[model samples]
Target chain A: MANNKQYHVAVVGVTGAVGQKMLGMLEQIDFPVEKLYPLASKRSAGKTVTFKGESVEIIEATPDAFEGVDIALFSAGGSVSKQLAHEAVQRGAVVVDNTSAFRMDPEVPLVVPEVNPEDIQKHKGIIANPNCSTIQMVVALEPIRQKYGLNRVIVSTYQSVSGAGNDAVEELKDQSQALLNGEDPETNILPVKSEPNHYPIAFNALPQIDVFEDNHYTFEEMKMINETKKIMHDSELKVAATCVRLPFFYSHAESIYIEIDGDDISIEDLQNTLKDQPGVVLEDDINNQVYPTPLSAEGKTDVFVGRIRKDLDVANGFHFWVVSDNLLKGAAWNSVQIAQQLIQQPGGLK
Target chain B: MANNKQYHVAVVGVTGAVGQKMLGMLEQIDFPVEKLYPLASKRSAGKTVTFKGESVEIIEATPDAFEGVDIALFSAGGSVSKQLAHEAVQRGAVVVDNTSAFRMDPEVPLVVPEVNPEDIQKHKGIIANPNCSTIQMVVALEPIRQKYGLNRVIVSTYQSVSGAGNDAVEELKDQSQALLNGEDPETNILPVKSEPNHYPIAFNALPQIDVFEDNHYTFEEMKMINETKKIMHDSELKVAATCVRLPFFYSHAESIYIEIDGDDISIEDLQNTLKDQPGVVLEDDINNQVYPTPLSAEGKTDVFVGRIRKDLDVANGFHFWVVSDNLLKGAAWNSVQIAQQLIQQPGGLK
Candidate 1:
């Protein structure tokens, strides 16, 4: 029942945060790979990355690097992905992009395998991975939406620093130590690195995740709002998000409120639906004081869903606490899962 | 003309977190305090607190401690307030309780000075200070409500550890230091100290702010919901809250979404209303990356409001980022303001 043929895979941006996670996940999941190419920028080309206890030298991520690659995982920044993804596709390799460049493109399918695996069939050689915050939320809400139908969603996120890349993670650690030593935090590379006026993210929460648009919503918030509507295939669905970067280093936690289409939805109903879902784990046990936290879900692949409760005032409203490793389910693991799905599909890469 | 007459003031729980803040605020505002009594638990009775460069001895909080005391600010705890508030009231002290002991008592007016200072005139001996999260939110929203008429409120709080008192703050600091040193965190106080199974709050976000009730909502969430309705004097207002505890020490941040009663309400309208409102500062210049964070609002008296925007889908929906020092505007300063109101009233303590 299983295809045992191994294919050549290329992991782009191999020196960065999510790219490193992609290499680790590919080995952890034991993906069928005959050859591996670890590609990064010219500055990091000579670096070596470990895969399956074997050291692989990083190569430059150029257009010719995608030749003979069956699946290419791109976790570089948006510009790098935009410059090279089409080249990979033109070389007959399926591209799973982990950036915002192609996510809202109708030609590319934004997919969470558990929620919309069927959407991949519509892809034109490139599949877009949803934002880390968006991926965990859709995974937790899809079962509920399927059973009761969702009308509205309002989410507040406590995102970690790793989503910004490895440099931000180092900044958080250094700032935490400095603050604890009663020293002023050295500030740079947070709440949008390119923007002026950087604020320290250690022991603090920055309300802005990305640059603000004309509408006052940050780009990260818009990604959550827009990508959610596209991935769920419901443009009429009401979605709003407030994305904040916290001091945590790995996982992102969200406080989600959703209104079901009809009345009489119970906590048990939501719990049962989540428990039966493929990539969701239910951890809600209020009596034992059980719920999901970012630190607890740091290295986990599945989205941890907990804190399920019916709204006190709204009859159809329900609340949930969702948590997952941003690097895993939010980026690398989701891209690898798409690659897994691509290999599993009949003639998926032809 | 302002009254020059002084009054005898009592600061209950003087050795505790909010109690110390109350003492500082009383002096900072240059209140006409002829005499001051600092009361605390018996264990902390011998502690000395400084006021206006003078040291005041901490006395044990007892029924007789309020004798001839014109105004008593109670912040010790709920049980302590419940036991001694009436005793102090019987002794002719106008009690401004900071705990949830009598907030929803119907007879006890829950007052935010900027929002409903007039409600203090209706107080029968005791005026309850609303919950910290509720106080800042209502202060920011009251102006909008007065101008546009509010129909619904949905808030998610990123509350700090100091709101749980000094022990929780110490836990956060200790856990943070330990985690940074690569040691396992020793958890004792958090997400309700009375509840079993404490989770580390150093680098994590806990969804539970207080222990859960039968309906699966935490007591803290219910407090926000019920207190908002009562404080606004609008029972029909649809309000929901999901309160989470973060690792920050002083200020609490809220992500609030509100539906106005009428359509065509613009962000400019909301900004103009907030700009003119008392005790509320509008810091919403996204072009310069101006927004309030908990660190920036620490020790501030005003409720900092920003991130104001109109919802993309809901015609009347508006969103805001509200931040304030939970101990100041939320607890201590609000109580002191109520005391100030009491002093200005004719025959206030008679």
Candidate 2:
């Protein structure tokens, strides 16, 4: 493929939150798209989404929808990806999946460009994007791990409602307004939409993000724990996570504790390593009270790292507060970055 | 000094949030109060606080305010407590101080009645109340520590605005409404009111609760770490905390991880130990989506425990989600419980 040649790009689940974000990010980043296919479920098929100031019709996602597509970004739920991703791959298109369907698949490489750009080259016609929480954590930890060598990690996340999807975002708004008006907020989706019980996410924190696994950990937490290990490629590293949902509309903030293998690493060493890392911005200054909050990191593509400090008792332990736009760096922008990596390979994507 | 005898009680900082809660708890519990003297700073001296459907005129807090008082409940700032607690104690009043002034004092015993009631007997004139975050955590961990023998602990707190005082609570409400209305929320009191820079806590999470100490841990986080050891009487316990202030108004929730000493401790064993403990209500039914949220635990005195699970990798490690009314069990109610224990002593309070 030549640099001047354009590619036919397809955005699957184009009407969903991250799907919509993928479309906007493609336009913002000026991806070389000769033709755009906005694909969705049959219910949302006829809907039109604006791209480059022109309306693009959403077509029903089917196996044949990938006919001439060069890259397909899948942001639909896991089942949709499970059903359509391979078909897209078989049609000679590289699929960058945003769902968790193939994240743990040994055959598919899970890639965060900042942390593991080379993993994109190992994909077998499909690449898996990590979870929103896991993406930001690994991005912040990767530079430190490369410099200091990570031994263990313990993370507690303060996630926003947007990570659940567009409906959860709407539910958060409705519930917040209803509560402000002193009425009971209707809850149809939250914690887990498919689960039997739903909790209100307005002005409250929900401990369970996805449904529980047999081991009593929510699948969301398990995703963070397992995906961090897979992305970092450190199977022996100890990682633990507690993922909670808060009422914010964008960005997820994490309180992370990491133990470095070396005992001589200072806060300055960690800050210096993260300052030069790609897609990461260090915003730590205790005297100025500067640290990243969810709202502060909204609409940003960079993972903001701050509140870096050494643990009082643990000699090699350090703590950090990492925040990033869950939709951008966590999902849409990351998928787009991987697609760009595929495009920028010498002789282009094979 | 007899059990049936009514005692004179002085409620210091009567105009503040926790002080007002103290007055309500005293009335709700029907403590044997012969006369109630509501004492505040000179600025709030004329304000009236309601008690048992009667208005009590607020008097200026002076050393003479404790002339006839058997117990003085102090919820004012630490400076006020440092300046007045000793004076009140010198006037023959048993002071149960709620500020952080004397919590770490070698002579002062920090008491949580449910966890360490015997420590109340050793108070040298003043019994210090532990920080709100520490009180709830120690309450939830005491039963497990006693039965299983604890070795290490780590906690991340989701604290509410009320823990910062009443003005901070009002700021949260104002900031939330302002943000909802598409206006920039004014930040006069949040993260730290006295600090030079303030961050909005409406839809954001602030990692710093109090000012940063020399060790880079915020005063609030340090309090949780230091005070927990003092209350538990275990100097060898490894405790680390990351305290974050959320947008809620009443309850503080904590995600706590602990490593028990015994290898055979199951989730059932931890649950059984906490189920029978006083002031702890176990709400750990995952099937029913039963877990304690700040909204669900508001105005409740008991510490609600849920989401009990064993760590996936660590054999002896377990995790818990604990919630309690920060102003109630964390401050006012804990102080009242200490006073109750003081009265229940065989010879009454010395």
Candidate 3:
């Protein structure tokens, strides 16, 4: 075994949004790292990112990049992760993947550190980060799930265009300007870019996110459905999602209706559970008009949960609103938490 | 009985969003208007609006201005409508109020022409246009309700800023530009302007649309809950809403979960019913990548319905996505449809 020394960390896809967030979080948390490796595509190889007041040059992400790394954080495209994640795993690096490539794999533990930190111990070499939408949701619901067993979850997401990537953010900007100037707006990246027709996202809501699946659900919707089950490890948990992209640039808001197993769990009890839970920010104050909003939740790492109320007529039903930065808790912060756990948990790096 | 040859139309609050939409709809539908009376507050009384290529001067909306007018479309603030709607009714003008003033009044008929045009005949001098969100939902659901009795409706809305009125649209634009240019964004018009301490909406989602009620539901949500029952004329219908405003300029998207009375009603049946219904554009082709989006629904008059699918395990339960321009279907078009019904239906005119 190695002596008590800081681990050498490598961040793959350091140029992307989630990757950029991963770098920032690493600095914020001051993850004990003797050496830092920032890896991106060949195009971004020469770019420099500051870590611990030291400028580090981004290297081309390749199989050899993880040669001596003890921990690797992956947030690149799924294809890139699929190609290099296993290679890094084989090279004795614990890979915390932030892509869908390994999330559904039985062998890889899909984790929200706050919700299922125990699952992290079962990982062989690679751990998968749950979907951004799924991460915040389970973080908010798991406390309630633990207190009052969850039965069904119906969530509809008001996602920002930023979740689609940085380009969609630009598209929203250009399109909004076009709409304001009375010019014909252009759409090349919304509701699925490869899809034949692109709709103006400037003033519209698109019911479809990601591409269509064999089932009626969009890929984005299915991600929420499947990833929730995997993260919660409850195949029997009834989950349905409608993922819609709004024109906002950051953060995702979810209107979630959840049915619990217990017969008489009051809103007060649920609120108490959330208020005590880690990584959860309770923002439900009706009198002062304080509640979780996507804008207010933006740039915040904690999952903001509010609007906790029992259903009007249903006994075991409750509805709450959840908001978190899709870039943070939804993606980057989650990946970093997994890495932080890797350093602290027993046998995490062995 | 007044002659059908020409109806003297008075447009109340002629400078506002829904008010402007009402005027445009009157022109688009070409209501047989002998004289166009544009009415607003004293501040806008002398302002002129183009009606059929002719500029008509705005008049101070008072009891006297409504005299001899056959139909008056009121889209002013709720308080203004509450104060003057009866006066307009007393002046012999049939009032089609687009505010919440008389919507819950049992004496006034709450009408969505496509859903319940017959209700217009029961109007006691004033007919209430349903809430924009409620208007679109009922328009889409009425067909399904006709086929399969609706037991419960759970809707979480992704509403546009324009639904708050013209000021919100300007605020969104100005705030977004301010954010982009690294300037301090102002927030004086959203989430109830009367509330102290405003939040930015440029890249955010606000869960509260109106003032919070004691029940923890926003006034906007209550409007939806109450309006759905009133417009559907089913006081016992279980309807719940979580109204949210995204930074979109127009259109509202709703993720609606509904339980039908019959177990035999399949997703296909619901799709077919909506596809064939008037004022509904069914866009649910998931396999070929077709579905309704708020962006595509923007500027369109029809309610775009898609993502129709039966709940995975629950029988008689279905989920669908509905999108429509709040400015149009939610406000402008519904008012026009009311005007058209008043002209077309036998004894629709008071």
User: Which has the greatest DockQ?
Assistant: 1
Error of 2 at B344 (Å): 0.6
- Model 3: pairs clashing at backbone N, Cα or C within 3 Å: A132-A330, A204-B294, A204-B295, A205-B294, A205-B295
Q: Is candidate 2 or candidate 3 better by DockQ?
A: 2
Q: Report the first chain's TM-score for all candidates.
A: 0.98, 0.98, 0.96
Q: For candidate 1, what is the TM-score?
A: 0.99
Estimate every model's Cα lDDT from 0 to 1.
0.91, 0.91, 0.86
Candidate with maximal TM-score = 1
Q: Encode model 3's per-residue lDDT on A1-350: one tens digit a residue.
A: 22365888999988888888898998898788888889999999998998878899999999998999899999888999999999998998999999999999999999998888999898898999988888889999999888889999999998888888888989988987787778999879887887887787776777778887766777788889999998888999999898888878888889999999877888788888999788999999888878988778888899999998778767888888999999999998998888887777765466
The digit string of per-residue lDDT tens for model 1 on B1-350 reads 16688889999999889998998999899999999999998998887899999998899999998998989999999999999999999999999999999998989999988888889999889999999999999999888899889998999899999999999999988999999889999988987888878899999999998778998888899999999999889999989898999988889999999999888988988999899678999999999999999999998999999999899999999888999999999999999999998888886454
| Model 3 ranges off by over 4 Å | A1-4, B1-4
Ranking by TM-score: 1, 2, 3
Clashes, model 1: 0
Residue pairs in clash, model 2: none
- Per-candidate DockQ vs. reference: 0.82, 0.69, 0.65
